[model samples]
Target: MADRDLRDCFLNTLHGKAVDKVPVLSVTQTGTVELMKKSGAAWPEAHFDAEKMADLALSAHTIAGLEAVRYPFCLTVLSEALGCRVNPGR
Candidate 1:
């Protein structure tokens, strides 16, 4: 915990090591309508625009002080690439 970064905090938990305090992180996806409004990174657009997607991702940390950032906006990102039709759930 002494001068530990987020990676340290997360890795420590996975490895059964000690943390001074539990880091703020989500066990699930962090995207939500409230976060979209707060960060001005709504869906549909964020689904396609990397910058918008990044804004939404960072909101979890910037607004809630999470120790980590979740990178995927949708679970279907690779669906289209894998021969499935993907539609934006705006």
Candidate 2:
């Protein structure tokens, strides 16, 4: 499964159903510094900008072969949601 095409496999795995292969999923995939530079979507900016966040979040799917991507990126997202400032860097 290659990220965008693994929706059914992911859902099936969650439902305790068997799949051809285990879906490679992650809610905490880090966007490397190189990826940020390549995509022009820095972490600090991405945290606040939806487009930047989406671009950075898709890096893993496009480059790493993740079976799925956590939309808007899911790194410590709750902290921001709970009114805490997220510090820059991985």
Candidates' C-alpha lDDT: 0.82, 0.74
Candidate No. with top lDDT: 1
Regions of model 1 farther than 4 Å from truth: 1-4
Taking the tens digit of each residue's C-alpha lDDT, what string does model 2 give over 1-90?
A: 444448888788999998887877576655778878877888678877989988887876676667676766664677887999867664
Q: Please give the range of 10 consecutive residues that has the lowest summed lDDT in model 2.
A: 67-76
Best by TM-score: 1
Which residue ranges in model 2 land beyond 4 Å of their true spot? 1-5, 71-77, 85-90
| Cα-based lDDT at residue 85, candidate 1 | 85
Pairs clashing within candidate 2: 3-67
Q: State the displacement of the C-alpha of residue 86, model 1, in Å, after optimal TM-score superposition.
A: 1.2
